[model samples]
Structures are given as structure tokens and as C-alpha cells.
Target chain A: MDIWFFLIQVLNGLQYGLLLFLVASGLTLIFGIMGIINLAHGSFYMLGAYLTFWLLQSVDSLLLAIVLALPISAAVGYLIEALLVRVLYRRDHLDQVLLTYGLILIFNEAQRMLWGGDVHGIKVPAALDWSIPLTDTLSYPVYRMAISAVCAALAVGMYLVIQRTRFGMWIRAGASNRDMVAALGINVNLLFGAVFALGAVLAALSGAIAAPISSIGPGMGDTVLIICFVVVVIGGVGSIKGAFLGALLIGLADTFGKVLAPDFASFSVYAVMAAVLLVKPRGLFA
Target chain B: MTTFIAGTGLHTYYGSSHTLHGIDFAVRRGETVALMGRNGMGKSTLLKSLLGIVNPRQGKVTMNGADVTGADTHAIIRRGIAYVPEGRGMFHNLTVREHLVMSARPGNDGRRDWTYERILETFPRLAERLGSLGTHLSGGEQQMLAVGRALMTNPDLLILDEATEGLAPLIRREIWHVIRSIKETGIASIIVDKNVNVLLGLADRHVILVKGEVVYDGSDLTPESEILKRHIGV
Candidate 1:
């Protein structure tokens, strides 16, 4: 194996992993903080992609499209929280699973109805369209590198927010005991709602960012959602730091497995998850 | 002697099992009210009812002259009530400092009486264990942290359910001392504990529940009185 070729694979893995972190962080937040198992989380990711595609067509700017699409996704999440998810907080996990699964179906059909059953892609913005030559025969896209950088920054931003800010304290407190935080005079319901909306924004932002790199179709979110669950499970359900490590580990494993043995590419990631669970059931960071 | 909290005709049920039966409870400004009852007699339930933790099927709760029946828990807290719930209600993952800082707000009554330094000064044990997580602390330390966290909210009324349920005698005495100092600060408090003698000394008024009804309400009774032996004795 050429060392340069291996380096390229590592870079690819980092990019993929960072994107997975963005999605999985949101999933973990929703599950960890609010105790809601939201299957429709992926729908927001799909919506982000579709909305980006739609918005870019009209605005012709990736940044502008993202700026417009995020708040919309957050609003949608807030509405869902108030109308549907709020009713299920005290309900059983099985009930939440059923309702969110129903949400997945509704969002899937909504995307199909609005955007039709066709594949779509966003053009890479000119600023990040350049590539760095790794070898005479190989070069890496600057956009991919930008994704990794953006994700790293986001990971740091998340850490600072959770560890340093007062809102983050409430979030951590809520994760531990919702009632205790409320008893402290914090509006736990409103906090949970804001968290749910933030999770949606993060998930949608991941999709918007990835639209240029991956194909967006009717079921684009389904595969990513399943993979995100794997990431969250391996990362520990509520820990953002855990999601970062888990995404990178899975990203590299999946990428290298695809390159080395296409037949077992999917199996390798699951194998890693199973092996991790066997050793530490809660997760690596939990 | 302004009324801090008043609940009348409170009837609460936990899934068809009636808990508090038309109980009337009140706490005056700067007064310490002790809620006493054996296990399952709705001692904690009454506290829950007053704070809107459990919605009373029939009741009128007025806090600072505002009707707050079935109000949301955070809303009740925002109205200047802080609760140290049963079992201490500690967050296992948060550190001692995090617990104190998470709920810190200037007193709604325009008094900044309880900053982190004042709390640390009050509970030196907490200052020593500032970085320790809630699960890492001993039972006594957790209780102190609970009270300290409640103080950080600078509440008009503080409620502690099972204020000192399981602790060594020394720690219990320390908690009683803390309560006494809190009383000196003129913050109204509602405490629930089994130590009747300690409460008799500390509380300005005592309300004893027998099977969800207030069987005794008085401040003048001595610890050795017939009411204590007949109703509260095991």
C-alpha cells in the first residue's frame, strides 16, 4: 500500500467522520437531553439538502442558502416539538419510537411530493472548489478539507458551549435530572424545545454542507440516519465528545473497508460497533 | 408576617390513589414551617402540591398573592420558590460548582444575597469538593450541596423534602445549624424531616400529617406533648 494512497484515505475518512459527527451530535442531543427517540431526525437532514438545492437555485449562494435554510428547519423542529413531541415526553420509549417512525414516513413522502423522486446535487462554491495535489495521479478537494475544518470548529464550538456557557450547564443538568433543573427555576420545557430545535439545525446544517459531496434523493436520509444511530450508540447516547470520536472511528473504518474490501464494507462498521459494545456496553466515552 | 405561600383545599391523587386530602398549608415570610409525617402519609405530596410538582385535583395555591394552581414547575420556581427535593435530587454527572452555578440567579426581590462565594463560605465542605461530581460525593456532602444549590436561586421560599433523611448525627446537626442560619437570613422555608425535636426547636410552626390530613398544626406544643406521642410516635 502506497503511503500517499493511505494518507488520502485517512483524509477522506476524516471528512466523512466529521460530517457524521454533525449529524450524530444532533441525534445524541435529542436522545440524551429530551429523552426523545426521533426517527424523523434524518428527515431534517433530507430537508436541509432539498432546501439547499431549492434555495441555491434561486439565490446562487451556498452560504446564503444555508443561512436561510437553518432557521426554517429550526422552526419546523420547534413546531414539531410543540405539536407532537411535547405530548410524548412522559410517554414510553416504544410510543416515541412509533410516533417518530410515523414522522419519518410523513417527511419522506413530503420530500417526494415537494422535490419528486429524483437525485439532486449542489454546486461547490467557487471559494472552496480548488483541490490539493496529493500525488501525480491523485488530488484531494479543498471542499472536503473545508468540511473537516468546519466540523472541527463545530466540535470545538460545541465543547465551549457545553462546558463554558450557562445554557450548556442547564443542558448538562437536564440530562442528569430534568425535575431538579426545573425546581431550580429553569423552564425545562422551553429549554428542551430550544435544544430540539438546535439539534434540527445541526442535522440540517450537516445535510446542507454534504449536498455538494453526496447525491440527494428520496431516501438519502434513511441510510445516514441508520449510520448516525450507530455513531451515537458507539459514542454514548448523550455525549457530544463521544459522538466526535465515534464518527471519526466509523468514518475511517467504513472508508478503508470500502477501499480494501468492497464486499465487506458495510459489515466492517457494524463489526466495529459490535466489538465496541462487547467491550464497553455504554460506549467508549459514556 | 406577610403570607409567602398559601394552599387551601388541596386534594391531590396519584393515579386514583388519593394522597393529600383537602389539606390547608401556609408559610409566612421568614417563617420556617415543618411538614412532618410517617412514610406514605403525604408529607412530601403536600410539598409537591404547593410547588405545583403534582397537580392538585382541587386546590388554590397563591404565591405572593398570585394564583398558581397547577402552574408549571419552572414557573413556580421563577415566582421565587426553590425546592431541594427528596433524595437530594443530585445530578450524577455535574460537578459541585456546576450545580451551584447552573441555577444561580439574582434574588427576584432585588437582593443579591447568595453568590457563589457566599455559598462557598457557608459550606466550606463544598468548596473543598468543588470539582467532584454529584455521584462522587458522600450523602452528607450531597445534602449540603442540595441546600447550597437552592440558596443560589435566591428564592423567597425554599422547600426541602426529607431535609436530612439519612445522615450521621454530626452531619444532621450541621444541617440543622445550616437551617438555623437560613432562618436568621429571613428566607421562608418549608422543611420535612423525621427529627421532631430538632424541628420543634427550629420551625416557627409545625404541621403534622396523618394519612394525608393535617392532624396537628401548632407552634406552642412541646416535643413531649401528647399530640407528638399519640399521632407521630412509632
Candidate 2:
């Protein structure tokens, strides 16, 4: 491909990487800390997309829609954690898989019933619709850049919350040694509930924000869910820092490989994942 | 004496195999006790039972005379019982500083005595490794870190299950020195170890278990040496 095409694809890769990091960060944290594999995580992302679309249609104000959708998605995430994930806390992973897989189906059927399985595209409220010129003929969308910027900001926020704050300390301690943390007097069940909810909200936010750029569909979350698992495995099972680096690597590789080598594109991401796994079966940073 | 903590008729099991059998034990406000036994003597099992890590089938555990039997580990910790479990159980990802921060007692109290300065003074080696991860430390240093982490809680009763299980001779000496100092502070501890000499070294009382039953209990170590050889085959 030409230079402009390559540059745009690189930009697209970064944007996609950031979004994946956001979703995978939650997945990794919940799985790492709670030791529960939630297959329904992707549904949060799809719900976010659907919520963004609904807000856009109903609210009419693009900025207002974006602002309102975040909290709504967060609440929905809280509900999912409260209602479903809580029950699977001690059950085997296979049970969690079955229940959450069942949830994915339920969510898809619900979305189909409520919104209809139509591609309801989101309009980039004229304000963010413009593009920055990378070349004479090729341009990168400003909105996508905004997604990257916002995701970076959130990553920083998450780092601060996990590394510096009291809650963050509790979480890391609990994740590492549940018995020790409890013996130190932390109400672990309550903590896990909050963490699961927060993870859900973030996952939904990724889905919502990416709605305009990525098409809205029933199976969107399933594809992202698989990628999130790969991302977490590649980054290290439960490390947020690992998730960030891993997402960027996967995003860049998947994007570039697709554009430059169509034949190898589909398998390149897994190839990178396998290589990372080979060195550290626990992932690069678990 | 402060009725700090006690367990009565504690019994437990692991994967259908019974381990602890109705063992009664207690720690007062400020007393250091040692639990000595050979391999598979249920010392660790008793500690786990007290901490709620191992569920007691038929017993009552109380803190300050308040029933806390079957209470979760978090609640037990909040009630002021810190345990340095077997193997140090440190979060290898966290640095020494991070471990201290994470180990701080959340709702413990107004007593601000065991500050960072004092802990660093007690274990200067850990002070140097404060920036290092848990896995980066030597066995002795990790043991010290575990003690430091437990001390940060300023616990009413600190239970050390095999605190010096595997350490170099010098580090072992340092750990004993640390334990002596901790005892001097008037905080009670239940130390489990195979070293009869160490148990006799700092403990005010001795309890040895054989196949989950307390075969010996008292301030006397008269037959403990003989008991250790026969039971532990030391």
C-alpha cells in the first residue's frame, strides 16, 4: 500500500488498539482478581453501542448523547454484575461460561427484539465529523482520534485508581491474596461486586464510543470478547499495564497485517499471541 | 488480662480428609506462645482454623470473648488478628512499599505506635528492598517482610505459621531477634515451627499436636525434646 494508506491504517490501528485496551482491561481485572471468566463481558460493549445509538436518536444533541450514555451503560453494567455474575462467584469456570454464554444469547435476542437487527449508524455530530489531513488524498477522522485520546485518559485514570488510591491497594491485595486481604479486614465480597460493576461500565463505554466508527450489529460483542481474551492472555492474565501494552500490539499487528498481507492477516494476531505465550505461559506480565 | 482471642473444640477438614480435631487454644492480651510439632502435626491446620481459612466443623472461636467462630477471614482480621501464613504468601507483583500500604489495617484503631520508622528500624534489610518486588527478596528478607506486613496491622494477636520454615542461618537469627522484639512490645503471637529450640527460645507456653490431637500442653518442655524425636522423628 501507499504511504498515505499506511499512515491512515496506522492511525486506525492506534485508535482500535486503545478501544481494545479499554475493554480488555476490565476483562483482565475481573478475571485476574475475581478468578471468574465472564463470557457476557462482550454484551456490555454491544449494549454500549446500542445505548449510544438510542441516545443519539432520542436526545438529538450529540454531546448530550455521549455524556448521558456513559452513566446509563454504567448502571446497566452494575445490574449485570448484581444480577448474574454474583451468582457465579464460586461455581466452576465451565458454569460461568455456560451462564454467560447463555447471557450473550439473551442479550442478542433482547437487542434484536428492542432495536431490531438493522444497522442504525451514528452521525458524528458535525463538530467531530472533520478529518485531519495526513496526505493530499488521505485523511484521518478526528472522532477516531478523540476515541484514542479519551481511551488514553481513561487508562491513566484507571492506573491512578489501581496504583495510588486506597481502593486500588485493596484490590491489588485482594487479587493477589484473597485470604490475606480478608484476614487484613477487607470485605472482599463487596469489593469484588464493585470491581465487577466498574469493569462492566468501562466495557460498555468502549462499545458506545466505538459505535460511530464500528458498525452496530448483534454479534459485535462476541468478536470483541474473543479478542479481549486473546489480549488478556497475551498481556498477562490479570495485569492492567499488560493489557494496555498487549492491546496496542494486537491492534497494530491486526490492522497492518490485514492491510499489508491479506492472506496472513487473520492468523497474524494469534501468531503474536502464541509467541508471547511461548516465552511466558502466564503471559508476559502475569 | 485482655481476653484477646481463643478457639474451642476446633475441628476442620481438607477435601474430605479431616485435619484438625476439636483442639482448644487461646491467646491473651500480651503473651507469646509456640506451637511445636513434627511434620504433619497440624500446627498450620490450627492456625488456618483460627483464621477462618479452614472452616471448623464443631467449635466456637471468639475474639475478646465475643463469638467470631465461622466469621470470614476479613472480619477476623478486622476484629484484630493478623497471621503471617506459611510460605510468607506475599503478592509477588507488589513491591515492599506496596505490600506495606496494602497490609495497613483499615478500621483497626487510634493506636499509632508501630510506625514505618520503627518497622524499618526493626528490619533494616527490608528498608533497602522497599522498592523491590516480593519475588526479588531473599527467603529471610521475605520472612521479614511478612512480619513487617503483619506488624503494620499492630495486631492484637499475630499468628506466625512456620515463620522461619526456610531461611539461611543468619536470616533465621534475624527472624528470631525480630520475634523477641515483637514479644517485648507485649503483643501475643502463636509461632509454629519445627525448631524445638526456637519454640523453647521465645514462647511462654508450648502446645504440640500429634495427628490433630493436642498431646502436650503446658509451660514445660521436659518431654518436648523426647516428644519431638518420637513424633517428628527429628
Top model by lDDT, which number?
Answer: 1
lDDT of 1 by residue, B61-144 (tens): 998888999899888888888899989999887899998988889888778899999999989999999999987999999999
Q: Which residue runs of candidate 2 sit more than 4 Å off their true CA positions?
A: A1-5, A55-92, A133-138, A163-166, A173-175, A257-286, B220-234
Candidate 1 regions exceeding 4 Å error are none
Name the weakest run of 10 consecutive residues (lDDT summed) in model 1 chain B: B225-234
How do the residues A174-232 of candidate 2 rate in per-residue lDDT, one tens digit apiece?
78787777766778888888888788888888988888777898789999999989999
Error at B195, model 2, angstroms: 2.7
What value does the interface RMSD of model 2 take? 1.4
Best candidate (score: DockQ): 1
TM-score of each model's B chain?
0.97, 0.93
